[model samples]
Target: MARVLYLGGLGRSGTTLVERLLGELPSVCALGEVVHLWQRDILDDERCGCGARFSACTFWKRVGEQAFNGWGNVDVLRVHALRDLVERTRHIPRLAAGHMPMDEVREYAGFYAKVYNAAAEVSGADVVVDSSKHSALAHVLRWASDVDLRVVHVVRDARGVAYSWTKTVTRPETDGAEEMTRYSPGRSALLWNAHNAAFGLLGRRGVAVRRVRYEEFLTDPRAALIRLADFAGLTLVPDDLNFLRPDHADLGVGHSAAGNPMRFTVGRLPLRRDDAWVAKLPPRQRRMVSAMCGPMLRAYGYPVFTEEA
Candidate 1:
């Protein structure tokens, strides 16, 4: 059985960083957001973390051959269409309610099973880190008997996430091509609450879940990794904290289809909280975001107060 550590949460919640850190372990194979594989990496030929085009990566090429007989055999458009229907957040509640048609669920699970199984076979790692950031997909995988699924639900402060989304998006993999992710403060807040709420619902339904707050992890990475390592069923190096020392994370070749451009980042990684939004975001926008996120913010231990007193 493939042990899949699925990262579930909204974007800009530090899932990429957490996935990269765990991917450094010998027993773990980090595949960035396989959800985007069909369109971003395979169809668009995006750069993999190994600095090669997706189709040019030897490991992924092997996975393609192993998973679907060959990369050419996979129909990108068809798979994407099915995925958009099955993995959309709007479909999550129904999927959980067992209202999703069995055929759709089967199709979704069968395709992903091949992907995850192929990844484990090609990488020779029992555990695969998939930072897909989709609560709906995570719920779908819970029913896949072929996979032993564990979830790491990452939550960041809504204000921090809202600010991150507003910043210019850049992908190191694409050089200067602008990443098109931008959301207004109000939209970001509403999505953050909904995303977090979905994951919470999953946990209540008795999924094997571990909640990791971005702020808490940054403050004490060693402790966070220890808990995560246990949940994902991996042993850590005695001095795992050394991974974060010198303000950089050592990275390896990862063939993630969709993720932050930082996936192309190698060598030492600086660790710091981006709280610039507190000082730079307009007071009115901050107040609006706080109001939108209101009770949910407090539920996650974020203060409802976004403006400086």
Candidate 2:
């Protein structure tokens, strides 16, 4: 069995950064957003984190070979159909309650397990980090018999998340014309609440869950990494994270399949809090997002009434 540290949360909440940092650890292999592996990597053949097309990345080629004999052996359509059936926000309740068809859920999770297991074997990593950021997929993985799943539920302020979604960032993993998805502030706010709340269910369902606030992580990345490493059952010494400095980290290219364009970043990357939302997000929209996510905002230790123009 493979141990998986699943980064579960809403999009734009810093899972990619966390996953990238975790990949710096010798015992961890970061697989970016395996939920999109079929569509983005296998079918579309987008760029991998290693700066090669997915089809050309030797690491993923080996992963495919180890996991399913080869990528060609995978029935991408069948996997996508299974994902659509069981991995959705609507299915989270049934998944948490174990009310969904167990057979179908297990079948879907089996594919993920195979990937994680193969990744661990090929990379010789003790734990594979899947920064999927999908609460629904986290819930679905509860049915994977061979997966030892632990959840790191990353969260950001609702206002920050809403602002991030409104920006037009390019998806560098694809053609220049394809930009990342954007969402209205309201939709981002509601989803921020829903996704974080869904992850809360995992702890109750007996999954090992750790909550990492994006703000706190940026403020003290060393302490954050220490906590995460401990949660993932690894003992970290100072040298294991010497690459992390007070304001930046020395990063190397990885083989993450799909994530924010930040996954493509390497070299000495500065680590700072992105509070541009405070200065740029409209007053009306900020207040609206705060109000929409009031309970969850406070639950996650964010000040709901602190937003200003």
Candidate 3:
């Protein structure tokens, strides 16, 4: 079986950073967001973490060959259609309840299994990290018996997540000036609650799941990395974590298929909590986000009422 560490969470919850750090492990291959592989990589030919276009990246080229003969052999449209059919927030209930159409779920998850298995084979890694961060896809993977799936549920303060969606970040993976999709504070808050709740259901279903909060992870990344490594069934000696420091990490070039522009970052990257929302987010929006994410915010140890609010 192909060991997979599936990072599940809402966007801007710091999954990309977690994925990047884990990718540095000797036996792990981090594939940014395979859910976007068909559209963003295969069709758009976006930039990979290695700074090469997906079509030109030797690693992915080999992955394509290993997974399906070659990228040319993939039916991007068919995969996209399958994704649309089963991978959505609305389908999470059925997927979690195990009431899903097994045939469709298996078909969708088979593509992922192929990619993950191929990634592991091509990278010579024992485990593959997929920071797709979608609860739906993680649930759908349950039908893929070939994949040994482990879930890392990354969570951030709902307020911070809401604030992140309010900002305009450019997508550097494309040639043209394109911006990442933005969502309202309310929408982000609701999503934070829903996505986290959905992943929680995985734990109930007996899937191996670990929840890592962004705040705690950044505060003591060394310890966090060690725990994460152990969860993914890898060992990390002290020397293996030499790349990490108290305040930054020494990152190397990765070949993630899709994710935050930070996926393309290399060298020394600072590690700091993004608390801009505590002060910059309008007071009214902060209150609304807190109210909307009330139970989950508390569930994740975030204060429902803050001094800033």
Superior by lDDT: candidate 1 or candidate 2 = 2
Per-residue lDDT tens digits of candidate 2, residues 1-309?
Answer: 999999988899999999999999989999999999999899999999988999999999999999999999999999988888899898898999999888989999999999999999999999999999889899999889899999999999889999999999998888686999999999998888889989999889999999999999999999999999999999998899999988899999899999998898899889999999999999999889988999988888889898385
Q: Write the per-residue lDDT of candidate 3 for residues 68-171, one digit (tens) a residue.
A: 99999999888888889999899988998878788989999999999999999999999999999999999999889899999999999999999999999989
As a TM-score, model 1 comes out at 0.95
- Reference-based TM-score of each model: 0.95, 0.99, 0.98
How much is the lDDT of residue 51 in candidate 2? Answer: 89
- Provide the lDDT at 146 for model 1: 90
- Regions of model 1 farther than 4 Å from truth: 239-241, 307-309
- Report model 3's TM-score to 2 decimal places: 0.98
Which regions of candidate 3 are displaced past 4 Å? none
What number of clashing residue pairs does each candidate have, in the order they appear? Answer: 4, 0, 0
lDDT of 1 at 5: 94
lDDT of 1: 0.83
